[model samples]
Target: MAKQVCMGAMMQCSMGMAPSSLVPTPKTVMTSGVMAANIMDNIPIMNIPPFGMCQSPSNPVVAAATAAALGVLTPMPCVPATPAPWAPGAATVLVCGMPALNDSSKLTCIWGGSISINFAGQVTHDIP
Candidate 1:
């Protein structure tokens, strides 16, 4: 059995500008045999969050290259959006599950990785 791993972060919006929109995009880079069962299990309910939006591209070549490197079955594209008002309170996001070799197998080695959110324009968040 694979032990469940959960990671969470509280991101406070301080864009310094009123009425700004934000689209949270989650990116994951993992070793082969790992699958993402639910990307929204721990994520907060925001106006809009781009989940699995790194597969499509304006150029087919770029998309193909990205797909091959990421080992994704289907490519999902990230769409651009205008910034909206910054809601009060901290925005919470979480990623769950450890990389598993298979349904009945789990990797013993510690997997090293990180998650990041790409925002438009100048913006800062209190995340560590």
Candidate 2:
């Protein structure tokens, strides 16, 4: 059904308008095609790219824009701010000595948003 995640994997955010791609460094393991990623690949711009625009009110930019628009929900450019790793990762499957990133993995955005994996980077020829 699902499989491991790799670099350039498509990702989305709950408070984001469009999807973005994952940018991992291939810590522990890497697939034949694209380098596999782990939970440690949760960096801000280095690993996670922007998701079009952000719609969360908690974000300062969005908040300011909404305020300027007279209480209207005005979205702003997305700037991912994840300070931790993907939760509930494959603990048993270590990548770069850390938990391997799974397709169902979820990353949190500090601006009140949840990032999710839309599709793994690899098309075929993967371990699982």
For model 2, the stretches where C-alpha displacement exceeds 4 angstroms are 26-28, 125-128
| lDDT of the structure predicted as candidate 1 | 0.28
Query: Could you give candidate 1's per-residue lDDT for residues 18-44 as a string of tens digits?
Result: 122322233362222222222332232
Q: What TM-score against the true fold does each predicted structure earn?
A: 0.16, 0.91
lDDT tens per residue, model 2, 1-128: 55788987899999999999998984546775668888888889889989999999999999999999999999999999999899877857887778888898999999999999988887765576
Worst 10 residues of 1 by lDDT: 105-114
TM-score of 1: 0.16
RMSD of 1: 17.1
The TM-score between candidate 2 and the true structure equals 0.91
